[model samples]
Target: MTPHVPALPAMGVVALLRALLKRPRRPLPSALPEIVTEYRLDRLPLDDIARYRAAFGFPGEHIPLTWWYLPAQRAHLAT
Candidate 1:
């Protein structure tokens, strides 16, 4: 069963919108990198996944494909 989660307050939404609007945008590279960048995970982050699922109301039976974005974003920032 999905747990009940509180909705975001109106001020919280306004704050998020303000932050996003004020953030600077980055430009994409003119040319693609000669070598492909790949990210590998030696082990799954089960605890983190569990927390993510609970927060997002995803079922715990399996890992959702969307969870991959977490690692991908981290890898992008690291490089």
Candidate 2:
């Protein structure tokens, strides 16, 4: 014989339906005032640049393709 599965209680089923039908709350706007911050990749410190290059295994003096994300992330966080 197959084992019988228990069903959810009426209250539990109602709560689940209410939860499923509930609308998502809208996100609140930022309270902090906007500020502009300038970022210059060329101005990065020599040591930091050296470390970045070394981490990515770039022997030559050039920024890697993956390094572009740094500036993009900085800009996004600034907003």
Candidate 3:
């Protein structure tokens, strides 16, 4: 059977927060034309835009967002 691991140490939390805080805040990418077009999006299908949006969780979106942090957390937990 696999052994259970404890939660992150206080230092680990602080370090992660520090690293995240240190990252520069930049504008979101503009490659997503549907989300940034200046004119009406009548030509763009809503389903396509929805699909792209579904790929990432927005601030107010109900979709799960923890996967973004899973890799780093897993690495730290492994150590």
List the global CA lDDT of all models: 0.84, 0.77, 0.55
Candidate 2, residues 1-79, lDDT tens digits: the string is: 9999998766778788999899869867769667777766567566766788998798888767677687788888976
- The best candidate by TM-score is 1
Clashes of 3: 0
Q: When superposed on Cα atoms, how far off is each prediction in RMSD?
A: 11.6, 8.5, 15.7
Q: Write the per-residue lDDT of candidate 3 for residues 1-79, one digit (tens) a residue.
A: 9899998756678788998789657878868655432323245344544554566644443433454354456555755
Please give, for residues 1-79, the per-residue lDDT of candidate 1 as tens digits.
9999999766778788998789558877889869677777989988889888988999756897899888888988987
Q: Sorted on TM-score, highest at the top, how do the candidates line up?
A: 1, 2, 3
How does model 3 fare in lDDT? 0.55
Alpha-carbon deviation at 11 in model 3, angstroms: 45
Off by over 4 Å in 3: 1-42, 59-79
lDDT of 1: 0.84
TM-score of each: 0.48, 0.42, 0.20
For candidate 2, what is the TM-score?
0.42
Instruction: State the TM-score for model 3.
Output: 0.20
Candidates ranked by lDDT:
1, 2, 3
Residue 35 lDDT in candidate 3: 40
